[model samples]
Target: MSQLAQDRGISVDHGTAEDLPLTTNEIDLAALLGVIGYVNDLEMVFSELARVVSPDGHAIVPFCGQMVLFAELYDTAAGQEAYPDTLDWKETYPLEMAKKATWRDVEAVVSELQSVGFTEITTVKTLTQPIETAIETVESPSKGHDDGSWIVVHARRE
Candidate 1:
C-alpha cells in the first residue's frame, strides 16, 4: 500500500499504527482505520499519537468492539457448542485476551484519548453494515461474520 501510494506521487511512510514513523508534532491529523481493536498497547499507542501529533491536532479512531470479531461466528448455536470456551479463543485469537482489546465500547476509547491529552471526544457514528461487503466475510479464511457495526470515535488533541 505504501508503495502504491508512492507510485501515485503521494508521499508514504512505512510504519506501524501504534508507532508512527513521523517526527514530533508534524502531523495535523491522524486517521486510524480499523486496526486499533487488535493493538495490544493502546496506552502506548495513544502516547505515541500524542507525541507525534501537533498539540492541537486530532486523531480519528474507529472502534470495533469484541463483538465485531466474535459476532455471528460466536453468537450462533453451533458456535456455542463447538467454541463454547472463550478461554480457548484466547489462544486462537489473542486480541480477545486483552482487557482493552475490545475498547469496552466507545467510552473506553474516549477515556484513553482523554488520558493522553485528547479532548472533544465524540462518537461520530455506530452503524451496522452487511458483512459480505465488509473486511471479513463468511468466505474469509480467518474469522468471518454475517454482519457487524463499528463505532467511530473522533477526538482532538489539546
Candidate 2:
C-alpha cells in the first residue's frame, strides 16, 4: 500500500479524485472535513467518492453555511469587495474567503450533494445560536453571532 492508502484517516494525498488509491466498491465511508470549499471541482470529486464507496457506504461532508454573511462583513470591515474572490462558487466554494471564515447554507449544500448521485442525504447545522440566545442559554459573556454557522451532510452511495 502507498502513503495515500495509509492516509484514509489523516489525509489522502492523491493526484486527483480519479486517481484515488481505493478500488471501486470498496470504501465504506468518504468524509470531507471542511475540504469541499477548496476543491476545484465539486461534481467530479463527488462522482469519484461515489465510485469508490461501496453500495452500502456513506459519505460525510461538513462545510460552511451562508458564507455571504461573513464575506459581506469582511468586505465592509476590511474595505475591500474582492479580497477573497476564490470563494465565489457555492457548489465548489463560497463567496470571498476574505473573511476571518465562511459558512454554507444547509439546504443548498445537501441538495447539490444529492443531485450528484448521493442518497439518503441528511444535514445538521452547527454554531447557529443567536447572540441573545447564547447569552441566555449558555450564560457566557461572549455573545454568539450567526456568522459561524456550519453544515454537515451525510449521504449513502447507491
Candidate 3:
C-alpha cells in the first residue's frame, strides 16, 4: 500500500487507529473505509480522529452492516452464494482478521462521530439489491439507512 502511495507521490503514515501517528489538526480529511468493524476500541479511534483532523474538516466512513452478513448466510443456505467471485477481487489481509470484526449499525456510527465533535452527519446507502441493481445505485446513492446493506457516512469535524 505504501509503495502504491509513493508511486503517486502521496505520503503515507502507518499507525493503529487508537494511536494515530499524526499531530493534532494535521489532516483535512480522514477516510476510515472498512475500518469500523475491525477496531476494538471505537471511542479511542474517534478520539484520535477528532484530535488529528482540522476543525471543519471531514471524515468519511464506509462499512457493510450486519444485515449483509445475514444475507450472505441466507444465500449460502440456499446454495446461491454471492461472494465467491469477490473473494479474490483483491489481495487482502489474512482471514483471521475477520474474527476481530463486529458489524455496527448506521445509527451507532453516526452517534459515535457526533460524540467525537463531528457534525453535519449524512449517509449514502447502497447495495440494497443484488449486485447488478446495486451497481446502478452507486451513481445516485439513496439517502438514509432504511434499505441498504452497505452504507457510507459523511461527517464534518466541528
- Which candidate wins on TM-score? 3
Question: Given candidate 2, what's the lDDT at residue 78?
Answer: 54
For candidate 1, the TM-score is: 0.65
Query: Cα lDDT of all candidates, in order?
Result: 0.63, 0.61, 0.77
Model 1 pairs whose backbones collide: none
Off by over 4 Å in 1: 68-104, 128-148
Local accuracy of candidate 3 as per-residue lDDT tens digits, 119-140? 9999987777765445444545
* Candidate 3 whole-model C-alpha lDDT, 0 to 1: 0.77
The TM-score of candidate 3 is 0.78
For lDDT, candidate 2 versus 3, the one ahead is 3
- RMSD over all Cα atoms, model 1: 8.4
Clashing pairs in 2: 64-103, 64-104, 65-103, 65-104, 65-105, 66-104, 66-105, 87-94
Q: Residue 135 deviation, candidate 1, in Å?
A: 11
lDDT of 1 by residue, 1-158 (tens): 77888899998777886778999999889887766766878888888888888988988786555555444443442334444443323333322333334333565677888999999876644324444334342332222212335566677899
Predicted model with the maximum lDDT: 3
Compute each candidate's TM-score over C-alphas: 0.65, 0.59, 0.78
Q: What order do you get sorting by TM-score, best first? A: 3, 1, 2
Better of 2 and 3 by TM-score: 3
